[model samples]
Target: MSRKTVEFVFASAVTTNGTFTVSYPTGYTKGDFSRGVMHRLIALQSTFESPKGITCSFGASSVTVTYKGTTTIPAGSKGIFGFDIAGPDTFRETDWKKQNHIINRPAILRFVNFGSPSTVSTTALISAATGTEMPATAASITYTYATQGGSSPIDGANTDGKLYPARNIVTTVTHASSVPTMTVTHTFLDVNGNQAVETHTTSGGGTSNTITGSKAAAQLISTKIANASTTQTTTGATLNVGFGSKLGFDIPILDSTQIAMEIHDGAMQGVWRGNEILPFALGANEVGTGGVLRRIPAPINGRIVSAYAAVEVANNANNAGTIAISIEQTNSNGSGVTVAGCELAFAASATIGTVVSGSTAEGAATAEVSTGNQICVVATAGFSTNAQFSGSIVMRPTYTVRGTLAVADITTVPSGTSGDIYGTYTPAFTLDGSKQVGLLVWTPEPNSNGTPQYTV
Candidate 1:
């Protein structure tokens, strides 16, 4: 809403240290104003005028002026007095926030003479102010919502305040619309909050800088960078990579042996009681050997590197026989086939705590296992009832551990300077692929000489 005021200067000179009055022949009225003003006035006048330093006041029907200036009022001296169109005594505008006006046109104002030319008379005729139009008025009125795309225009079909003082800007605005904000679930923004990413640098500069994120003493969406931060030594240095690089697994192993041991329990699987042998669940003594000793699920895609089984207790000394156990796996065709070079053998005299490696004499097909495959620990033909033994298998990963990724999901909060500041998260799987592939890629920011060091 807007409030347009029309005012001008009083032509005739004003009196010094004297009084005059202005009257509204027609009765005046009052209403609410945008500035929170609710005065019982159809017209307003300045209590003090410049140059003449005159003072004025309003009565129920007239405005009285008292001049106290040391000099005579200039001939074309200007004075401002605002008067709104007459309206009902009580404000009728329901949206009380807007400035209201009765209508627009010229106002008739009669100024009483000022200062007495005759010193003895004490008061006499002086000048009067000019006239102007008080065209209809306005102050802005609407509700807006600043959303994802942009701030929608003033709601409702009313308008953008095009009254007497047409303008697009509003001093006070309140957003009360129930419109929800559109969501931008995923966006390609940079880690530094800049536009498209730049080229990568192979090294770091020599300055120290802290890249802070929305944090509470925890998390990795940020890191400390440097204009000249040392990366320590090449062979052994602590590296602060902002996010994961590419496809890889968080297997609890970091080496070939460790990975092999991860696929199966490294401990012996068998039952024993105080050095006494019992009937084996694996048919260790009953079947004599040459049958399935145990079966386990192949939980990962890897190559079996070693397989071993051992006797937990010696067979009865009365009967003599030989026993051997080897690792085997069910292929996609469901056929139980023996793995190459993976076996553990025992002689009739074999005692407690005897361990033997699987033969490992098979082709590559039997050595590799896919997820969902079943592992079978088969034994060579031999027999005994007290032959108790334990077994285990080990396999190494067939894929490289990327351990990193290229980009992370970024979220930003505006900061006045360089650009918007952002924090990020690395997704648990490949970015857009449905497959649960663990992969991430990372590169130094363009124009950034950031160096990533190894943490030893």
Candidate 2:
């Protein structure tokens, strides 16, 4: 016979101790079914259960196995042939308590080839844990190849490999979609309760700095920056950063929607009288658009019965002078406060704000204040002389203001001038329902400077 004809004849024969052929049905899952077939046939072809009781049947187009019990071969299935026979079995633990323990009963299998079977232990192959036994159109199957001695033949070919045919398994579970939201704020002030200025190193030696006060403190809290003073820098002494002084304060953020702050008012009280007194012009340049000082809108409405303003004056023979500062506000035209449709006049002695009649070394001395009058800060001592004073005052109508400024959300508070100082969260999630609630909070950060650069 010809070699080709001999090869054909050899391939057509089914060996009881060596090989077998697999024939998938025409309507079987259209793609790969190797693993599916293998898993199904493994149990049917098992000899460990009954040894000789297990047997295999070969057909002209496909193969089947018969055992003590009945079995079925779907459109796509697998088969294995070997001289050694083994199958799944059950083991028990000596002690009842250890029966369910993994160490007590473990699955085991043993097989040996009697003859020089080239496909016994040598060509033995098994699929990995078949996650499930579904008739996937395109399933994957894995098998192993070994030498006649049952040892791996390829260098690393024996290593584990995975296969995912054109199919997948299905599973069901539950997941969640919820998150969180927060906000922050900060403030800066001078030892004298005035806005402090800081020099910047980036303004081409310019003396531009952030103004120190509740405004600066509010900025810090809102931005969630660790330290604002450290962020200030300078290059040359051509100019001092007098835009704002170096001042720091803490404003407590109570809740997502509210915050409270206890500000440090500079020195002596009642220095600033009612609108009756004209506030020192400082100069026409300081007056701004209106005759009003630039200020953050008050959070609520109240009166400044009195205040404390403090200052330190350096002795300078060439520039010896004194100046004082004070403030007063009112809802004179019913723009701020009105009770029971009755318009209250600021001219009324009852309409009181704040008065600072005290003085410090650098500036103003005794400045009397009254209702419907301007609060004044008069220099009682010399500016060039060593002078410093501290004082407090009485407030009327309970100083209460409303905060109307809109705040944004925040993620992380910036630190050490390196990380993000502030962030706003959106599409805020809630712990309660499918929808979410939006709000904000200020995260806390430690101080960088132990004390103020200039004391009040």
Candidate 3:
């Protein structure tokens, strides 16, 4: 790289605030100067008092330096200064190319002495400068699921029949820059409440961060009911067992079974339950007794979102009955109040091994299902024969937990004097040959011989 040095004597020595302009070569503009180059120029120091108190500002095609009132320059003497200017090719190339070529133009130092305006001292300063390159902005974050080691259906015991356990899930956050903070949350259905929740938080300055957490387990309830030989009219059977312990389960049963299921919060207080009745005649309303199916621990406060019951009827010569499944909440008096229900009627010729299902949305009214509730199932024979059926009851509840992550704000650089120059300089002397000051802009090349290349 080649540098152009030009010097001009002051018309008159400056004793008060004044301004001087340095115009760039033709076809060059301020946009060509990189922020790194500008910063280097601003750090230069001069022995002469005039350039000491001077502040520089950039323009489209020139630089204007404003001097304070306290600055002074000797008459008919030499003053030296050095700084980097942009070259035509500086803006056209990449940062790597610019750094390797030292593309900045040579420095032009002009000193205007008092008493000798026409006798200006013009000197071109040149040098090679290099420094570490810092990132200009932060990078965005990337997220993904980490490998989870475990078995499905997380069923702790075989007695619970295929009940699924909570899932242990992990999520990783990554970035090219640094990640200061991160938060992770897990949500799932709860048998005791509307939902179950878990959360995790982490903080550090690095390229990556990981958050580990797990979802709540789902609940399942399974049982078998035999047909009633006598024409049952009321909920007469009693199976004392805990229900809604963790989450809820589905009801799977055979067809032609006259049964009803009910849930309560111990104390015989009904929480929710359903029933199925067999018809004696072709189109008769099947009626049956409601009894306690299971007594379960009270669930956390939450609303029921969904409830369903499925019945599979076996092929029988005489099979004419109706199946109904329902979910209800108990009143303060322990009475059952239906929130949602599903019913299906079976014909005499209904195909053997046929399946019928019913479902209702429980989340609409935000129905509350308290803890320690009792669930019951009852069966009724429509006519002389009892319906042979099997099924399960499944319910899903939701829980919520929240978390947040915030990054610190960046501070701004204040405006003022940069600092004293780092290199050496000689005082201006009139008797010596037009004294010269050279400044060359250089940047170290990582691939080269590790020497800074001078840019003129």
Best by TM-score: 1
Worst 10 residues of 3 by lDDT: 123-132
lDDT of 2 at 367: 25
Q: What overall lDDT, based on C-alpha atoms, would model 3 receive against the true structure?
A: 0.30
Candidate 2's TM-score reads 0.15
What does candidate 3 score on TM?
Answer: 0.22
User: What TM-score, computed on C-alpha atoms, does each candidate reach?
Assistant: 0.28, 0.15, 0.22
The list of candidate 2 runs beyond 4 A from truth reads 1-201, 205-412, 415-456
Best by lDDT: 1
Candidate 3 on 1-456: residue-level lDDT in tens? 122223444445655456665565445455543221221112113432223344456687666656543546444434332233333334343544542434443332222111111121110000110011101123111111121111111111222322232222233434445543423233333322233333334354566555433222232121111222243211221111111111111111111111111112111211233332212111112222222222333344344333333333332456455544322345222424333443455565655365555555645442345443433333324422333444444444333211111110001111111111111111122312232322121222111111111111
Residue 345, candidate 1: Cα error in Å is: 2.7
* Regions of candidate 3 where Cα sits further than 4 Å from its true position: 1-321, 331-335, 366-368, 378-385, 401-456
TM-score winner between 1 and 3, please give it.
Answer: 1
Model 1: what TM-score? 0.28
